[model samples]
Target: MLVRIRGAWFVAVGVVVAVVATALLLVTRAGADTDRCTRFRDAADDRAGLVTGVGADLLVIGDSYSVGLGVGAAESWPTRLPGRVRVGGFSGSGFSRGASPCGDVSYAARAARDLPESEIVVVEGGLNDFDQPAAAVEDGFERLLARLDDRRVLVVGPAPAPERAAAVPAVDALLADLAREHGVGYLSMAEADLPYLDDGLHLTVEGHRQFGDLVAGALSTARQPGR
Candidate 1:
């Protein structure tokens, strides 16, 4: 289907595809009844237990997963970041669906129009594009990164979700290549020790904390002296 979002015409990405991705995205959320990540959950006040670093104002552009669907604002990972964090992205967004059906602006376009001053910017998505054609995914990624060329940015590849176990390598490689092509930092969460909810795709609160810590560490390391 052709979708016009934020003045751009998008074609080929499927609503059903995005829907399936959303389903997978939720699979790893809470209430799955098989999650052990929560077995190690700390008290509410223990939110700082994961890891903390010198916070920096951060802009995170991602999908529902990044926005913390099914979770409270304070409990969302972005909110947990040790800095001023602004979270924005459509729930089922992806590179392929840049001009989203829901009228959400594409990340690249959003950055082009208005990217707030921040220490770092995170451009995340793609898990929702898992089933999409690589060509389209790359096209979208490239367009977005092109607009972000002037910013200190990090490109986070998709995580290793059980549902995408087999295709992880190719997708991860594509994302890594894209990041390298633009000379931006890239983080591979495919093999990271993040705890997935139940559907084995979405991340639990603890998982978000861990991921946030990872991002924070990377940001810290990036600002370190010449290495």
Candidate 2:
């Protein structure tokens, strides 16, 4: 059983053996401004896994979708970023965990207490929060963005999955509004040029690769002068 906790893998294994994802993280907060990285790495042992360390000023956080659960290690958009980036996040995480069975900590809490410094931070998570009241998630999301202060943040809404087709738009709208309010970038994954898998919860490797390019383009345009 997959516990609704950060760094805990939740993929329902159906075969005798399966590959374990290496893009996992465990962070602990100390004081009001210290987020120590407990663990974050790719499963290099896996045939398709890739090893990449974090040190760059780019941080990406979100749930299993953003963690690239269904794709190869290097095929993940985060791992495939054009430049070096400090990637650290967990699957099953979201904006805020109310009665949801997906996460125990809100993305806002994680951002406020357990994130490293970065000029650009891409946050993508809201599927778990979609069932909850929008206002509640908005509250946490606002605080999350506020904590970043001067940092540039890009809100990547939940990917367009068959399961979330009907409900993701609302969350995406909410994020778009927040992006405007905070003068940040909001990339609507719903409109992203990608394809989904059979489960409809994850994206294909080609999809991720293409999405990575789109994300890179959006980030560049969003960072432009008077864009």
Candidate 3:
């Protein structure tokens, strides 16, 4: 009968539509996974470059916080840093070995070997050293600065943790003294108005932009004809 024929046609059309829809869903999911995998691989490759010795004008050294995990390389503050800045920080790296379960390489040693003779050097690590004594952090920092000689240094202070911000003042003071002794400038994340912290720690996309602006301003001032 005509009714039976029409019913079969409708069922066939519905099946075709369902198959197409399922295929689209799978394709979309696969694309997303591929993108994530690509980002991971890119980050890993960048780290390898650092370990193998790639020098740059402005070397940024730090840990995961500096690595800008979950954020693109261009969105990282170091990459965004103006006036010839380059990335040297590896994800999960710290100032001293055993500082973090993920960190083994010494940031200072990496900088000494990999950084070129540049006017500016930005060092952004210390949170991992918080559990350790202040003296240890200071000593490690001192060694790093000594290697830089007279190159302008900007020691980036840690972000504001709900509880850790209280200790930042003391830490900032110590960092300031160190900078003065070495004739280097220091910049603190606490001083910058960070409305873009992803989780009270890492800078969000907007935060990275703002932080980059601050770094540029500092570099400009330091490199001014007079001061």
Candidate 4:
């Protein structure tokens, strides 16, 4: 009986150790991912002349869609945008949550940071906040708008993806409502039929071009007299 008890205790200890190890591994991986994101951001800044602290005509703060994660820099939508544009995009980031798959960056956090000066600031990407509570997402949007109170701000709602189609409209509606309440211009892509990659989430190069043109046109329209 004593031997059996000892064996059970040993098995229990092993399970505990395994759980601890798995947790450590996850933490380590998360830290590594965060570090990688920081490096990528720094490199992007260098490439975009942001390292010089020079401002651009437009500043876009968003997630992987803005970064053109799977495509070349030139193929990214921001590059297709007219005039000088600076992009602040991180993967797996959203307004309501941080410490995501890519890093601890969130839209609210990005807005709170000292951003480069720009004539127009566009806050994009809220799809990641789909699973989060409505109250949390609203709070995040409020915080972000509060930070950019002095800037000409536009809120771009996330486009629909085949994989997440059901959740897109809710987020889009919430963003549109918030934009209206905050007196900011809001663009809704909930009904946009854009090409997507195999994952049915990220946009293709062609999709980027389409999106860029749409936004460029919107900007032009907004700039017109009596707009």
Candidate 5:
């Protein structure tokens, strides 16, 4: 009888262990699936028909700064840009090699795939590359511009940060050189007078308005006649 009891106890423990292991495996799988789903959903939402019905012949691509951080989509500079500009920016996006926080897609790859053939292609991104080596930043920018081919590109330099304003000039100069080398237009928002930049990085609502106006002025001058 004691032998039978021992056997039963062993069986019960084995079953319990198996159940716990299965539960753990299932939980892990569910978490991974959830993460992949979230990434895909965010990418899909970001890539949704932004240019539809806008009559945009221009495409704008960049990180949160270019998208008008802390502001609604309507208040973005691309939205406010004259001649129906379509915006293809994602927040927290960088020109890094690893998986993007905004999505699983690489910024350069996404730009090549999603960017429309436009007379004007505004490429803005660099702040996120602060920690990365300057070579990496330049390489990413070069790759992005390579995809533009003969298209008229505009490389908007980084914004001014009170802590980094001194360094801003060098970064802006690099971007300017890149644009010139690629034969594209360049806009330096770092020189613009925008008092609405909170924390010297992201823009406030008023800042967004000011950026939109700045972009509008640039586009007004750059846009093809009657466009």
Candidate 6:
């Protein structure tokens, strides 16, 4: 009887230890994410301010595509864009979902905090929110648009990628619908035949140039007087 009781006690202790360890790991991860987000946010904020100081005509808030993750910043599409454009992009950010492996820096949050004033604010990105609920993504986008009420806003949907081909269409459609509902300009890259790297996600350097050209044309048309 005593031996059985001892074994039971051991099992209970093991379970408790496992539970405590798991909890500690989760807390540690959360803390690390918080730290990373703080550092990233500070740096991004400073950069945005500098861009604004240059009298930026356009401000773009997006994810790695905006940052040009694989390619260098100078080669990024945002840089290739016309005029003095400021890009506030964080890797792994989405409209609803926060930056993965980082802290809570979503599109709505960035629009509300990180970005500065500009003549045109382009809200780009939805790829990261692929698996997220549609309602959540919509809610986040609504919040972002609310904050940008005073600015000329443009909603740019995620580009078509072989990897996320299925989800990309849904996201594009949703963003397009939302932009129309909000009476803002919307750009859908769903059928874009852009080149991608091996990852089949981000655009290649050439692809970025093509994308930049496309956007420049759109902006030019929008700039024309009257409807």
lDDT of each residue in 1-227, candidate 4, tens digit only: 99999999999999999999999999999889778778667645543553212335788888777777666556777776666788877766788864255544778787677577777777778888878888878888888777777777777788898888899999999988987777788888898889999998989999988887777666632221112
lDDT of candidates 1 onward, in order: 0.64, 0.63, 0.62, 0.75, 0.65, 0.76
Q: Which ranges in model 3 have alpha carbons more than 4 Å from their true place?
A: 1-56, 94-98, 196-198, 220-227
Candidate 3 positional error at 98, Å: 4.7
- Model 3: per-residue Cα lDDT over 51-139, one tens digit each: 22234466667765556665656566665565455566655444555454433356666666676666676777665565656676666
Poorest 10 consecutive residues by lDDT, candidate 1? 39-48
Ranking by TM-score: 4, 6, 2, 5, 1, 3
Candidate 1 off by > 4 Å: 1-56, 98-105, 220-227
Over 4 Å off in model 5, which ranges?
1-48, 51-56, 96-106, 163-166, 197-200, 220-227
lDDT by residue for model 2 over 128-223, one digit each (tens)? Answer: 666778788878777776677677777778766778778888888887787777677778877765688888777898888777777777775343
Worst 10 residues of 2 by lDDT: 32-41
In model 6, the Cα lDDT at residue 101 comes to 56
- Top model by lDDT, which number? 6
- The residue-level lDDT of candidate 4 at 92 comes to 66
- TM-score of candidate 2 against the unseen true structure: 0.69
Which clashing pairs does model 1 show? 27-199, 28-197
All candidates in order of lDDT, best leading: 6, 4, 5, 1, 2, 3
What is the per-residue lDDT of model 6 for residues 1-227, given as tens digits with 9 covering 90 to 100?
A: 99999999999999999999999999998898788777656655544543422444888888877777676566667776666788888877888854255655788786777556677877778888888888989888888877787777767788988899999988899988878777788888889899999999988999888887777666632221111
Query: For all candidates, what are the clash counts?
Result: 2, 1, 0, 0, 0, 0
Q: What is the lDDT, from 0 to 100, of the residue 72 in candidate 5?
A: 52
Tell me model 3's lDDT, rounded to 2 decimals.
0.62
The 10 consecutive residues of candidate 4 with the worst lDDT sum are: 218-227
The superposed Cα distance between candidate 6 and the true structure at residue 220, in angstroms, equals 3.9
